[model samples]
Target: MEVNVIFSAILIFIIVYLLFSLSGILFPIDRTWYASLKKPSWTPSGKTIGIIWAILYALIALSLAIVEYKIGLKNTSITFMLLWVINYLANQAFSFFEFKAKRLDLAFLDTAVVAITTLLLIFATLQYSVLAAILLIPYLIWSTIATLLAWSIYRLNK
Candidate 1:
């Protein structure tokens, strides 16, 4: 509830938003190509995906801020912090692999990595704050689902 936590959350949110946005902007999705993909019937609409990402990004920022506050940003364990950083980078690359590069296999691989990192991030967060760890559960769930979806899409497309 400290001001530092609030400020850190806001700052991290902006940083995440900007960095993620850059991926989308730099390698914009080819709608025509994406539309051609043989997606599963359960695939969510683009709007739904966007909305879910918005919520997940917000939760990610807050969770990270809470963990950082508990552990002290300066004193954080490299391994713990790397979990989130790795997850973010992997996530940002998904668009590149799936949309720009049009590589479903790589996309599926990246999603699996993201899901794995989400688990590590949650476990690492637990050492700092239970609330922080719990906050990341949704992300873990979503990433797992995404990995499955990615695998399905890759298989279907091939």
Candidate 2:
């Protein structure tokens, strides 16, 4: 595909990803359960949760847009970009299913996928653009910690 077409495709992917991710804010899922769960003592406030995700997703979107604009989505960079899209969508879907369906097992799996794919994105981003890669560091670190949290939730709730 042409670089422009690829960039457009990635843009669409990102928009859809954000729209779906935003669903958590729109609908009140089992936040009560989430709250009551045995979170680490340092668990963030609900407001913090919202703000952090918003900022992270914004960074993610911006990094991707930067990659598309500067790198033109025409080389190995596209592969990295595509991986990020895959993980982004997966993360959204996992979050939705985890909360809406109350399927902790599925949520665990999906969250793990998101974590792993994000790591790949971090690695891939380094080659394409250091700035883009650095932008994802917070997300990667959070997801790594999130992986631990998700597993703990599974054990505590199961």
Candidate 3:
């Protein structure tokens, strides 16, 4: 890849990271409310969640950058772009549902949407760039875990 492509990838990653971070801020978690709920013994600490999400966001940005670079933005199919937008919206909805609204049921639904969109994204990217699809595997796996975790929490608390 060219130096410019690398820079663009990094830039895209940063921008997406910032947008996700903004959701965290807007839907700030209520620590007391969160702690009061019954959680799985294996649930990770706040620091751990932060670290993991940081890594995941970095991967997501890189995957998108790779696809854009390999296929070019103008040439990218409308379906591909739509899938990405859906994924992003669903991702943001999780924070709003779980943290801001304190609605686990809605959060679970949001996570499900995210997982589905992510899978579609993987398949869509594969048609254009295998490397991009490969890069998203971890994200899809993590989203699956997140979806299950949310469901478990909802079940336990309810």
Candidate 4:
């Protein structure tokens, strides 16, 4: 691989992880508070959630680079851009809604939006690169799970 491509991937990785990290920085998880709330019996441990997100974020960055390279970001359609942006924002919003604002209902809604946009994003990326689209499957699956978990938490806590 060209050094430029390597650098591009690294840059994307940093930017993608930074978004997730920024949410953490701003609204760091309150383990005590979270533990006090009623969660589904099936809820994953904190360490497992961290590991899953780390992997998912890496896949997300890779998918983004692949799609951008295949289609050229300059030539990417507005629909793709919109879906990607919306998904990014909605994904980040979960931390704020759930941790900072302590609003389980909003977090559940945000997760739904994230899942919907992620599905649309996968469809949009298919036109550019099937691999890129495929890379997002884990994220979509996780987001759907997250939506369900969020709803469950809201119902149990509220």
Across residues 18-45, which tens digit of lDDT does each residue of candidate 2 receive? 7646757744568776766666666667
78-151 in candidate 4: lDDT tens per residue?
99888888998898899999998999999999999999999999999998889989999999999999999999
Candidate 1 residue lDDT tens string, 1-158: 68877677667667766765677777787889989999999999988988888888778877876765665666778898788689989999999999888999999999999999999988888878899889889989999999999999999989
The segments of candidate 1 whose C-alpha lies over 4 angstroms from its true place after superposition are: 1-6
Candidate 4 lands at a TM-score of 0.93
Query: How many steric overlaps does candidate 3 have?
Result: 0
Clash totals, every prediction = 0, 0, 0, 0
- In angstroms, the error of model 3 at 82 is 0.6
- RMSD per candidate (Å) reads 2.0, 4.1, 1.8, 1.7
Report the lDDT of model 3 for residue 105: 94
State how far residue 154 of model 4 sits from its true place (Å). Answer: 0.4
The best candidate in terms of lDDT: 4
In model 1, what lDDT does residue 95 have? 93
Model 4 vs truth, CA RMSD: 1.7
Ordering by lDDT: 4, 3, 1, 2
Maximum-TM-score candidate: 4
> Scored by Cα lDDT, where does model 3 land?
0.86
TM-score of each: 0.91, 0.78, 0.92, 0.93
Worst 10 residues of 4 by lDDT: 66-75
The per-model lDDT (C-alpha) reads: 0.84, 0.72, 0.86, 0.88
